[model samples]
Target: MMVPCALHALWRTLLPVSCFINSVLAAYDEPQGRVATAMTLDPTPGKDAGPALPEAFVSYAFEFSSFPDFAGNSTSGPNLFSDQLLNNIGNITGTKPYIRAGGNTQDYAVYDPSLPVALVGVIDPERQPNYPTNVTVGPSFFESYATWPGARYVHGFNLARSNGTYGDEDLLGPVEPACRALGIDDRLLYWEVGNEVDVYNRGRFAVRPPGWDEADYVAEWLNATRRVRARMGEACPELATDERFKLWAPSYGGTDNGLDAVRPWQDGIDADGNVVEVSMHFYMSGYGLPGITLQGTLLNHTNTAARLAPHLNVSRALAAAAPGVPYALTEVNSLYNAGQPDVSNVFGAALWTLDFNLWCAANGVARVHMQQGLNFRYASWQPRDTGLAPKGTRPPYYGDVAVASAVGDLTRAEVRVRSLRMESETDAASVPSGRGEPLP
Candidate 1:
């Protein structure tokens, strides 16, 4: 399942990032003695084909603490490397990739006006070395949002600080500043209150008690979001309308982890009807989980389908309950815990990236945000040179560029994607077929 040496050399020359077209054509080399399977892509839309996707369908989610590093402030200037990479995709897809500045650290962040630096964080290696556990952001942190031109963002607020209690002013302290910073110039796409609240009852990062359930989560969410909306109304009254004042809700880790995905919807998580989209987080496998291999897990089309089935089901149920509300995989990547070292950073992951995104596009997921960090093994590119890694494109980034190319110019016409069924999960032809017009 490793990328052939010939293709590896081609990936190295993709500095301009537009060379994905040439590299993708030579993406696969058939193994000896393997039979080629026929895949018939019907022009007619199937029962499972999703709606026309947005122009910026493929996007990214950065670790909350690393936002300053990825998007340098006004003083240090913008990260030209990041802008170049994003703009390259925008050239093909007709829009720059949207950036979501949130992850585990988002819940841990607190605002401090006096701090000189954009952010000051303390990383506990035992919990997670990829990002900080306790994060503080100063007034300069808002400058990072202004760095990336033409890119909309979903700013995450501190939800975990409430610590299972509602109406905690400390938790609401960051809302006014964030609203004032991003509410202008249409730069804000949506506001996310938390990251993966479903797993807050257990694990090393648990913030809620053992008895906490979906109902408790719903109550807390309603209270906090209502207060957030009221604060925004006072801070930025112009953005308090139905058209703009929407939030990405629940931000669950999975369908059936500590909390069931559908239960929150049933519990009236969106009682105010301001929830514009449903957000979910996913990973193909954990970093040190057993029986995980690039070939059997990441590159296996069947495995991808299996992993996505539950999420798709949740999406379907949400559509039934709240029609027209889009569902997105706001936080997702190949492996959790900053990804596996060799398996996630290699060319095989590039192949996995294509299959994963195409499958999601065809299966009704509204958007897919591949999660990344400063030195995460599965990052599309290392934003800066650190002791652990260098500042350069990784193998998976080629897959991202190829996806943008496959999507083509969305501004010209509506795009519909359908996965062509394959006889084998390991078959190289298991890619989706996309059309520019609505399928009849």
Candidate 2:
């Protein structure tokens, strides 16, 4: 049994030198297969084999302009755009909020000396001339916010037809100047080149009227974006990563925005373009607005989710054009028809809002704009206070708070979901807006 030399011939033969080495190698390759202990694991612990968004997802809502520009005026008489309003804004809305100053005002391109002033319904070319230039970010430039609870900015690009769509009044000039004047340039988040162009225009520049084919639309948007970027340089920078400026849209329905305006802005690229958002809009359900419940808010929301699914893939359609820009539901809420009881101000709305947000996050959307004008304005979402002030913290608020919390746990969570089911019933007492039971 005790072999003196290195190994006796018979012992060596039985040992099979390579056998021991092979066993060691096999054990080293997949330690888990043989391990009986509970804790032994692979050394790599920090890497993920899944999708992920950044740590925090910022929130964006809007307040329209109610300021009057009287040259010698002392804006002291309960100005629609007041300090109290800004103060209240910080209260109702969350921190890092964005304001789209251009939506209702439009009038980009040619700076008009005469256009209707915000909230006053009076035209004054001398005061609020160009759509983009009319609204100021306030004197303190929302710097007043460091003292307040939370406030941020995301300026809207003027798409109003009062000025020609392709005019060159701005190389992003007016907005940059206003923000710089207010010292809010550093806080500025995004610059929407246009809004709801899909449904708004037949083609080309929606206002220009010659109209746009798919190719022309993409080319024009790219050109406009490139021009704006040329002006922004290293000073401000693109929001390619930051939560606020994720570009949000042609903003059509799942179909073209009614006038066959699909895939245009998303179809072309600029020579010097850095698109980070592909935007869209939706407001599908309500009892009397479209005059179709389809089912109820619950069924409506489920259908809306299905309806929005194909549209969310605009990022894919944009793959060749903008390459890296992601998707965003930039301007959205429950109903396009504000007067509707079931969808506009109902409990069902809360459920619908919550579901839509979950759907977007679940489906890989990068950002969303709840489209609020809570305070008074031409198109205030709720219209309680002046558009300058913030309001609406119930159902929309529920969506806001709940979605933020839900999305927090899912920093790019790609949970394997089987299917979503919902049942909506209009029984007349389920909510104050006079709808019925909602199933989710």
Candidate 3:
């Protein structure tokens, strides 16, 4: 069955990034039906009225890792807390979003205050361009968050050791300062353990012996959470008791990532009331895959929706199981591995991102941290002074703007997908306004 999407009337503010105006112009050949019309209303109303959209629907966040800083590839770069970035986010969403400090690098990171800067000795720089195996950075690295306006930080700590023992040093250097930063601003979102634990047994980044299961992960996670909590209680007593101060656990990756989410929650991983939300990662496709192309990965709604069905299904069940606890895609984007060059950084990504977020909102995802890194092709904005891409907003950013604007004014909104066609590419001078109307 072909599922119809009715996203009419909700995209009034879906603005394309100016840099991507060319792609937008190219999508339409000439004037067809209603030109340049904002989706105003649903032509076919549902049998029963839907509920109002939740505030979380419009919420957007960014994810960065400790590894990037050591390699000088920090997503924030010298503009650690960019007013331009924050203002742009705020303008679109009507709310300031949090920045998640976690990723593959988070698990590889260690809190060694002794080091002046981070040490990146694990991965050979020549071989691993995007991936860093080992890195270390000092606590002050988090001070950048202070510059970010109304910033809430979701920090991640290293949980597993090199020997596969579920332990790492109780490095409170980064956490303490972040807590202090939070004490001043009162905006620490949650402390997450490790990056993606499901892949630990595969013997990759943070190698572990074969047969690492949920029981092992839960035991180690609880220990790490308590250790951090104790330090937090001493360093920032206010945050220790603050209800908002919480833990997000079992961040897992892989196709079976959903199953990994289930085990920890079912086993009462966060029964101590410290865990506030269940978190996981999602990427529509990975870089260097055999058949991935822009049209297949970003344009086709059927493929995108099908790929996400498994994750969404698990998320729905997890929501039902936990009742009030929300499930979040702590790390998500169109393509993983720093994304594909033109494909992920184009106007099609803007469309894909808009559709992707609405799908998550409809399926009960509370928040999405679109992961970005230095000079990544799929980054919403270039964070560093890179020669590869211009250091400004990219096409995917427009999608963020559109999603935020889509949910900005409404106390309630519903998103549904419907079939719509775009005209072909033509010269810029004679291009049409590119309007869309509901199909009757």
Candidate 4:
């Protein structure tokens, strides 16, 4: 029988390597700024219990900097994994979450098979010097996956190889070592072909021409995935016939203007059997846009749900087009472009995360991979101390902890969201009574 690829992929990301104690979870109440009039959940009598929520529902989103900063580099001081932290994560989630090593930096990464050093300088320090990018990584970079016991890995490869900077051959070099470090087909998840390749034309990487569309992406993706599959077989015998050893591709960003779910359906990536997931990225709002504010962008649930509805609608169509294929938000957070400092890093961000993730499950999204990074303004856990700030949990991590507890054990039962209702009342002048007039 074929493994439930979508659910499996989503499950891997559901557990992340951060801890929010029970006390913290209790402390985080749904923010008072917005309150539902009344909500109810009534399980349907004959509905399939649906997929169970994994032990956790949030996973890590590491930037390319993680290679030297969090993964390898024992010589560079302390790594993100400590016995106490790992234990805390496990205790909170009840299972180890998968780690996704990719972000904007993943697109700029090149593989160096025989480099003498563990890492080469990637990002320009003077120009936002600390940001992770513009570098090549060696095999030692993958060795760090071993540090987290039972923790699976979803490794991203450079897909912007169109300029002859690298080829499918160069891209496949990391697979063998990654497989070895991950116990040779044991803990490795799917290889993401690209990071939001849909927006490549205007994106930071600008890897493709402005005229590029899903057709261009599909053709290149097919070729790359085929090569990666063949290499996986040669590197690990177990993967030769295992369907679970899959590729996730055509990761689209949160805009409906470009290719929609039908693109992957037409490309056959969704139902190919070996392809595990059709993933995308989502954010509540664009950073630095006019009128963008903390209350309006990340804190407002009504605004967020409306913004997310289009993507969810696309996912629903994709599920029908390729029956049994899982749809996932492989990368998601409150805001795009790293996020706004005080807003994305605060308690309200946690509330946003919890509400949004639950909404995904209720709406049939197989998995929601909550994205994070070291010192990123929107990160849930800060891996290293910079200046006066010491490394520790950020406010949004409590959302993850709350999700982990809410999900509990997926193996035993499922968290089935039955229904949602909204009833509005009005008085004289049509303003809500609580605020002195009836609500509109």
Per-prediction TM-score to the true structure, in the order listed: 0.87, 0.59, 0.79, 0.80
Off by over 4 Å in 1: 1-48, 163-169, 423-440
Q: Where does candidate 2 stray beyond 4 Å?
A: 1-58, 63-104, 107-150, 160-167, 170-173, 181-185, 202-206, 226-254, 258-267, 285-288, 298-301, 319-323, 374-392, 409-440
Q: Which one wins on TM-score?
A: 1
lDDT per residue (tens digit) for residues 1-440 in model 2:
00000111121211211112213322333435555222122222122211233222334444334222211123323233332333343333233334444344433333332322223333355533222333423233222223222334455555443133445653354544433522344555456676555544544324544455556555666666655555554334443223433333554433544533334543543333434566565556432443444235433433555557566555556655556666666656665533244345544455455556555544556666665543322122332433343533345455455444433332223221112221222221122232332333
Mark the regions of model 4 whose C-alpha exceeds 4 Å error after superposition: 1-56, 72-93, 125-130, 162-165, 203-205, 270-272, 387-389, 422-440
Number of clashes recorded per candidate: 0, 16, 10, 13
Q: Which window of 10 residues has the lowest lDDT sum in candidate 1?
A: 2-11
**Cα RMSD (Å) between model 4 and the true structure?**
7.3
What is the lDDT for 338 in model 1? 91
Global fold similarity of model 1 (TM-score): 0.87
Q: Which stretches of candidate 3 lie over 4 Å from their true place?
A: 1-81, 117-127, 162-173, 254-259, 387-390, 410-440
Tell me model 2's lDDT, rounded to 2 decimals.
Answer: 0.41
lDDT of each candidate versus the true structure: 0.76, 0.41, 0.61, 0.61
Please give the lDDT score at residue 298 for candidate 3. 62
- 149-267 per-residue lDDT for model 1 (tens digits): 88899999878887545446546777777778787677889988878998888886688888899999889888878888887788888777788888998899888787878788889
